[model samples]
Target: MDTSSTPRSAVVLGAGIAGLAMARVLHDFFDAVVLVEPHPLPADDRPRGGVPQAHHIHGLTARGLDLMEELFPGLDRELEDAGTPRLDHGRDVLTCFPTGNAPRVDTDLGSRLSSRALMEARIRGRVLALPNVEPRTGLRVTGLVTDAARSAVRAVATDDGGTVPGDLVVDTTGRFSRLPRRLADAGFPTPPTRTIDAGVGYASGLFEAPDQSWLALIQPTVCPDRTRGAYIGKLEGSRWMVTLVGACGDHPPADQEGFRAFADRLDNPVVAAFLAEARPVSPLHRYVRTENHRTDYHRMPAWPDRFLVAGDAVCAFNPLYGQGIGVALEQALLLRSLLAARTGRSTPSGPVGVAGVAELTGLAREFQRRLPRTTGYAWRMSTFQDAIWARHRAGRTTRRDRAVTWYLDRLYRAAAADPATAATFARVFQRAAPPTALLGPRVLLRILRGG
Candidate 1:
């Protein structure tokens, strides 16, 4: 082992939102950070081939936006200045629950309405500006280059006949990542995965719509009866991004006519009305990977040192719940915290090398083990809702799972009309509060009244 090389360095895979955001955190603690991506990242704000779901609506909760602002300060104003609409949830969002419309409860919670492309570009610009960070795009990641003992990954092997070495190797390669397979081949125990799929599919289209009263509209698929959901948000350039979703194998159509026709079947007719008046601007795009799955890396009995996985690579929630970005950013923060925790009682491992590289010895596994603390709330929020609606179940769930989901359904129904209840529900949805926060007596009173 070459102790002189990159004692405080990190190699991050996949430069999408997750990878890019992870790079932002890594650069602050490490000396040299290499961002490896298989696809060519365009300079302009356009969708890259790597993210197929880019064509669909990618949402960020208020908590996620706040996290981004924390990393890249003033990002909120920057996004707004670029024509991204800053939507006040209570005033700008209209949700049509299966039962009725949710009463608008004005609050300070708001987030920018922008395409994934736009958000990625903005974050990329800031991250790439860092002097210690290097963006290596169009490079193929073949596998993890491990130490002689196979106990730690020291670098990333690329098909270009080159390797990017770092003290710590991180994977943020989204849901379809092959890192686990590569690791399994390298003799590490493949972590078990838990999934909850609702047999859901989506068809999305971009339209040039007139200025509307609201910034976003949502009609989610629910249990027992409802199978359709819709979300249409005002993006930059006066373009509205519309995504129609269906559960229980009731997939939405990909064709333009079918896309428009499917909207008419939603619980909320507002989506249909908007579609009828708006002019289509892009080809209809279809996506079906909406399962809530988590690779239980934390629970893995044996984990290598100096290697970590974050973002969707660890846990991908149902996009319908809009938990991906927030959870990803939270995970990055967790990484930062874990790194900071080890800063004390650690000395330099090598001269003229990466800073804090000595602490990297055991931080990777510690970070992985603590990740559930951040992901559990978001994972349950999405999967529990899907339990009521998912047609294709991934694994066996206990009776308590069903019981918890039913209680959530009641809370949603009560939130439809009760402002106080809705506010608390919104807090939980935005990642501002935990799900248990809704179990308060006030929320219970509202639910009983609605019943």
Candidate 2:
């Protein structure tokens, strides 16, 4: 992995956020990087055949936004100039719950509230703009070409009966990645899998509404009490991206009338009132694959050399939690750190620091094992709430999880009244801070005191 005259090459699968970030990182360490995707990517920000969630609402967490800015310098300004609305979550987003609405005041958490398509388009555009990076759009990845001893991935097989050789191959194909089967076919060890499907479905639409009260409206789904949720936000172009979510078969209908009806069913009247007057700009799009899937690659007894997995392919969370992008960004930063360390780069180009480089095993193996240290919290933050829904009980529900949920309920209720508690809640849930932030003395005291 030496950056000096090693002439390393990398082939990254998928064109999603993970793949884009990985390609950017590989460009730093490798002499050449090839980014491959099966779908025909359009120049504009339109939904493609591969990504089903492109049409839905997607928010960048405060930390994810910061990481993206680091990965692609001046991206924040670029997004803002592109009409992506930047808003402080504490004040710009009016959050509601079954009990009531939380007070919107000044706090630290903020995001560039753009549609997923727009963000992806911007990131992919910047990534592909790199001189050393090559793009293979519309080329399907059929399988992996293994070495003679079948110990490592030597190249990637495409649908056109061609192979793209590389020193390293990365899988960022998200939840539906075929890397496992490809590994098994190569006589390599494939990891065990676990999934927690909440049966959550989404119906989203675009609208043009003049609601200056707040930049976004969020009514969260707190199971057993609230099964329906609404996220209405204005993305670039002054157009509103309204996404309605329902758990346990309570899906939102993909029609104008039904979309409005679902919004009206929410406890908050703000969501319905805004949509009631908005002009529909697009038809509703429904997405139903919101399961929490965990592929235990870190625990795999044996892993192939020169091959690795990252992003949703390893740990895909429920989309409702908005942790997918944040986790991917984290994984991207981690990749940079491990790569920079392995290559003996004195300083990483980004703002992210390589703090734990000396303790790593190999780059490929250590990436998978150490990832859970950061990703596990996001996974728990997402899946814990969904586990309580009578229909979402797929994983083991221990007494600890029940206790965590109980405390989270209290924290949610407290967040409704106390600004400090709400800010902590926002930071923790935003992935800007750790879960320990919720258990801090002041926040813990506020939660215990019944804010």
Candidate 3:
């Protein structure tokens, strides 16, 4: 492995967080990296066609913030300068957990609140600044170019009648990617698929936040009878993005009055209060196109060389968990490490060397392994908590449910009073730290002692 050798070239599909992050990491290992996006990405804080969920509220968990900082230093400051609200999770925002109605003690590990569109715009600007990276918008990727043997993909075809060849191709095309279909048409067997439809629906609209007040509250009410949840997140420019979600056939209505009524029914009053006081900045945007879907690409009997899929294209979680962006960032970090490990090794000049292809394939496989543990946890948590609401709706009461709810209630109350408990809970909620930390001996003792 010679460190002085010219780096490889790579192409990334989509310009969303995952795609942009992939391109950013690829720039470090490749002499030329091109990002293909189908929509014209804006230079300022406006919505793009590619990300339909742009109007929705987005926040980085403490762990995600740390990873982003490691990937691009000063991103936090950049976001702050752009008017993103930096929230101390324990102190600034109040969260009501399902375990109990007692408010959790707030801690200091803060989260950044902003619109998904704003964050995407900022990251895109930084990514485009790299000399070795090129982003070409409005070019749709129609298919992949594979060798006659069909064991590997060599290039990607675009609707513009042009081809972009690369040593590696990473798909960050989000949940709507047609790569699996294209691959199946190319004689490749479709990867195994899994779907869990909680029948969730979302309706979001931007509204003006009160002056001098930071609106970073998330009140997730679990209603067993109706199976519904709602969230309110503060965004930049003094606006707030509120979403009303329903599950198991309780879809949120799209109209103005219907939407507000749904918010009024949530266990938490925060969303309804904001809706009554704030003026709407945008029309209600509704999303319910896909359930939680994931493909086991790594477990495939065979895969094309020089091809890998990342981001939502690989596994899309229930957005209510707010894990999509964080997971994507972690994937990019992993991909960067894989490339760095392969740096000095011999590679096939004509196409990705067989060994090089194997390495990349392994990287994609590792992502698959990690997805279940990540998304699966959130999926189960959401459904399980929803089940409690369902039980309440059914007018069923059980000693077990009561006990669990009691413990959770005490935990939240303690969190609101004890900064240590609050910070620990925030870390777990952000997915930046493990949930087991909350069950530690000291924490458990406090919970038993009723804080």
Cα lDDT, model 1, residue 110: 82
Give the range of the ten consecutive residues with the poorest summed lDDT in model 1.
Answer: 345-354
Q: After superposition, how far is residue 157 of candidate 3 from its true place, in Å?
A: 1.9
How many clashing pairs per prediction, in order?
1, 0, 20
Which candidate number has the best TM-score?
A: 1
- What TM-score does structure 3 among the candidates reach? 0.83
Give the alpha carbon lDDT tens digit for every residue of 20-43 in model 1: 878887776777789998888889
Clash list (residue pairs), candidate 2 = none
In angstroms, the error of model 1 at 220 is 0.9
TM-score between candidate 2 and the true structure = 0.91
lDDT of 3 by residue, 1-50 (tens): 12234355689999999999888887776678889998998878888886
Candidate 3 lDDT (Cα, 0 to 1): 0.73
lDDT of 1 at 345: 19
